[model samples]
Target: MIQKAQEFMNENHFADVSRVQCLLRKMMSKEYHGLIDQIKEYQDPHAIFNIHGGNNLIAPTASQAEQKLVEKPADEIKKDKE
Candidate 1:
């Protein structure tokens, strides 16, 4: 799954500093105790921002989120901005 996620990330045009734990949870295969450390080590505050939600974050390199976003309907895109 991590390999798949990395592939997904690579296609989106994000960066290494953006793969936060929140994003990882979306693809989680098991519980992670090191989530916080992972987020701080990755997520890009400038591009993705809001790495402080409780899940405590998100960021990426081509990111799975962006890859999913690429598949989103036009209306969904509008909703994300709002």
Candidate 2:
């Protein structure tokens, strides 16, 4: 779950950016959709880079996506837009 992942990262001193990679691997797994159903609660679901929304999971809405974009470095944001 997301909390477990955060705990792993904290215990290992991993940066926040690493969460994106960590969740991406989990999201890509064969059990991803099933896992969504089991995840009754979660936080920052948008942090998963390429989410596949099952019946339970919800992908970032447009405004949320834009907010994430604003958090990036200016140059990176420009490159993304390009």
What are the models' TM-scores? Answer: 0.26, 0.25
Superposed by TM-score, candidate 2 places the C-alpha of residue 9 at a distance from the truth, in angstroms, of 0.4
TM-score of model number 2: 0.25
Query: CA shift at 65, candidate 1, in angstroms?
Result: 35
Please give the TM-score that candidate 1 achieves against the real structure. Answer: 0.26
lDDT score of residue 7 within candidate 1 = 41
lDDT of 2 by residue, 1-82 (tens): 5445533443443355444455645676664544333222222333443345433244444334334333555356446645
- Candidate 1, residues 1-82: lDDT per residue as tens digits? 3434444443444555355445776655444424323333222223333333345354434335532323555356446645
Error of 1 at 18 (Å): 3.5
lDDT score of residue 17 within candidate 1: 31
